[model samples]
Target: MATFRREKCTINITGTNRAVRIAGASGGFSDRQRAISSLARLDVDIIVGDWLSECTMTLHGAQKMENEKLRAEGRLMEQPAGLFDPTFIENLSPALPDIARKSIKVAVNAGACDAKLLARTVENEVKRRGLDLKVAYVEGDEVTDVVNRLIKGGEKFTSLMTGKDLKDWEYTPIYAQCYLGGAGIAEALKNGADIVVCGRVADAAPAVGAGMWWHDWNRDKDFDAIAGGLICGHLIECSAYVTGGYFFGFKRLMDGCANLGFPIAELFADGHCAINKEPDTGGKVSIGTVASQLLYEIQGPLYYGSDVTANIEGVVMTEEGNDLGMTAIGGYQAEFHVYICGLDLEAKAEWVEKQIRHSAGDAAKELSCSKFSLNGYCPDNPRNQDVATCDLRIFVQTKNKKLVDKSTLDVPGFNRWCMDNGLQGCPGWTLGNDQRQSEGKIYYEYYVSLLPQSEVQHRVVFPWLGGNTLDVKPCANMKVYPRDQPSYETSNPVNLKSFGPTTRGPMGWVVGGRSGDKASDANVGFISLLTIPKIQYLLDEEYKGGKIERFEIPGIRAVHFLLRDHLDRGFNSTSTYDTLGKNVCEYLRSKWVDIPNKFLARGRF
Candidate 1:
């Protein structure tokens, strides 16, 4: 057994002589069986499973509350009594004996909102199977009561992403859970627990704990090591992400990815880790594969966690071995979001852009906004009166939450006002889904805030050890910075006169894209198949959007364009129909663009 002690800002590693190996099993709430089977085949010291995503937490909380209500009402059979990831038991049951025999520890966030209950269930199952596995659970991330108290005390629970307060919201939160760190998991491991379960801990916390326990690293003194572990946890937390699962060039791995092997990290004491996979398993681990996962769902260079901050801006990725890559991270925020919905209208992109500029109160002031065609109708052929309408979707974000709320709520009023002007307004003036469009529905917003380490009641509970609980707390050295607003700038004008012969076609025919939400903002990245010297014309004339940043990745032959702050307040908080911004890429792809006829002759578009 290894032990770690903190002494005056220094970490002393004792009772350990070598590097540690940790494997990531299931990524989300699916494919547990495959993950467990892979775990059985891999020779790792510990297995970290990530079962909770942002949406899953909310869903599980709602389900748990509903089940509690049913049980209180004496209708116990109305709904099944189970946690969000019940399949975890089914996945781990068959592997429990092997895991116990090999002394391979397990950690997971499968508990969702009920860590104790899930731990008890797993303990009973292990006992019934005559397995001697000790199950420990980590709690105290549930902050529903705290949130309620704060709201009662007049805390607005402002949106860290959009800077909108809770007073402007119409929906009340049913549950609130903070993202705990790996301190409790490390404490449980120290106390000889073989399996650790947690609720709403950071997605990568399990691996971080396993690394800390294996290497005898302290979070306070070994900031670099802990930060490295944090990045390692994130890289492999998604199971196959670091092993070519979600790579953009996935077609290359499709044949070998039938049973994509989960990722494993060889964590060193010096804050450097090597990412790899099980032998004879599918998926490749290379620089590109690792970089793809590193860039996934990340907002910027600074990756903040409850326990430590990982600064990956200067980190370098290089191949260390066949199917292995290595990177180091050093230690370094709180954030929350809100969603507003039911604002729908139809108009041309130019008209919508002008309207947004007018609404912002200054035509010259740069406003963060995005507009996309719903393809509901053809805008180019307005003479086809038989084609009744086209839906032009728009989204905006500002410091004024009340103004946004009012904007959505006053859709009917705006429509009436437009009708008053009659012929003066844009031709074919109309709104979509008139009834639902008039009534804006407030969504329960996600508020991200920081809690002091001293305030977090972290503990480890051993279900097998007479249900004992050991108190623990995360390191207090982490410094969180306040959330800052995203800035936007107009793209440099493009020289369109030098272009040769071209044919107009859907941009999707010649480009590939990926789009995702980042707090209140939505980022969409596009890769052009043909060499595009300048795209400012397309940005200004076709998209009529702002904050366009372009760059190129080495070894990749395409230029990439990132449109920032494009989805307003993002999913669950945005008024647009494409809340998640998933459709933004498709919308961009569907746009008509003039492509060089030479490339079209090559049959590429």
Candidate 2:
């Protein structure tokens, strides 16, 4: 655990650590409406949800830009509605009485561009329904003006993907929303707010704030417990993800996906918690499902949020499953991942790039970006065929609609162009049969960076206090928190033969994995390195064969991998079917590999 310092100000730690159960009712803007009413009926103290997502940022940002243009031209028709998620109002309308009846507290970041507006709306609804819920909202996430000032001061706000500076960006930024943390949300909840609304807090902030308010956890003194809340928030933030919604082992789901149950976290005051769901709900809670979200969209082992940073390297999950099938449009992309075994890794990766470029011909200029990555490491003296392979991915993004115009192209557009050199690919070359990824579509190149918490005017307002507002202080390290943390990298290889007798099979047959695209890179994560686990055993079993990075968390018996540039430009800009890369783990699971016979005997399935 790491220690974080606070400023000279004192924070009141009033509440004792007691058991608190919170239900995850929504994952994002379009989550099922049934989730709210359904979870509200459960025996939970608080209901938290995540409505903000990366694309929603793009959507709202783009909408703001468009509306500005319309206003300038006098083409604006009044003002735009639903800048915030209207779905929140719709979902909460039916769940309000249940919430009030149970005296359940609620928190959510459903406010997209405007938290005050959404909060007021919720307040009005409460009053209209003759309910007694006190509603408040956290503001100050919209930092476009602050960002502009910083730009003038020479702050680059460089892209995490490319080193391109914000000033050098092609599109004018409509707004720069800094991700606020739980402090503001906690302040509101603690100050008698029954329903807390927020705008642009991190997805996990709702839960973190609820936990902070309930347990009076000091952000600095109780760093580890706060970190536990951060991790817990991450687990159920996406609603049913930790309860088998997107489990890699969906086929093993005892209860089918129909009406899958949302997850509930029984968080203790000290931050230890067990994740469960409503009885007889369509999903199941187990170590496998929980581990998937622990790996989703994380950049590294130390997960940093606006309020606190969580160290997830040693995080663990257990099956205690008292239950649970479980079970996006964008720029078109025609792409494929190729697996090649044996030497000349980079050389062969380059060879594939050249061939694709040659095939792309003049249309290459129309491409927004194209990336070729040689992923996965092969083990020397590999025991199985899969261990000797590397994934050479050809990822391309283009906004030019003409490139995909069927009237002018043959062989169904770019897919054929990328496949033109299939015969000349790397040694022992094998490619996914799917050829739809070659198509390109319009998508925002997802960019993420940090904004100083000190610059955020985090505040909370209570509707009952005649619209009273209170400013919440930023974290102590806000002034000095680095924009970038240490990057996680892997090294020191081991041969597959070290794992004993092997059988040829898919790693998913015995293991569980979860992957998501921050729209898909080679591997999406931040900083970490650890002892190599069996994922390195089955997925990267070859000794020094490929460069696929693998990570281990001994507590949970799990290994994670990072696949660089696997998806061209991710969901917003990709034309691939696996836009969000939710299927990446499943794809890896389906790939045949040499598995240790011993472990296979005790597999999850």
> For residues 1-605, what per-residue lDDT tens digits would candidate 2 score against the true structure?
21111111122333455567788989987788888888888778999999987778767766666678898999989857757888899999899999999999989999888788888899889989999888888887777688778768987775543335666645545556777788888898888988999878888888888889888887656766777888888888999887778777787775568867788886777777677776666767766677667788765555667767766675431111000000012333445677878877778777778887788777777766566767788788889887888877876655445663332123355666666787877666777766554444344545554455556688888878998889977554322334233433345555678979999886567756667765335342211223334334534432233234555555665555655455654556654556777766666566677777887888644
TM-scores of the models, in the order given? 0.67, 0.74
Superposition error at 429 for model 2 (Å): 26
Each candidate's lDDT (Cα)?
0.61, 0.68
Worst 10 residues of 2 by lDDT: 318-327
CA shift of 527, model 1, Å = 9.2
| lDDT of the structure predicted as candidate 1 | 0.61
Question: Model 1, range 289-357, lDDT digits (tens) per residue?
Answer: 676565555544455666666655433321100000001110000011111112233334455446534
* C-alpha positional error of residue 399 in candidate 1 after TM-score superposition, expressed in Å: 24
Off by over 4 Å in 2: 1-16, 162-172, 314-443, 477-495, 498-500, 519-550, 564-566
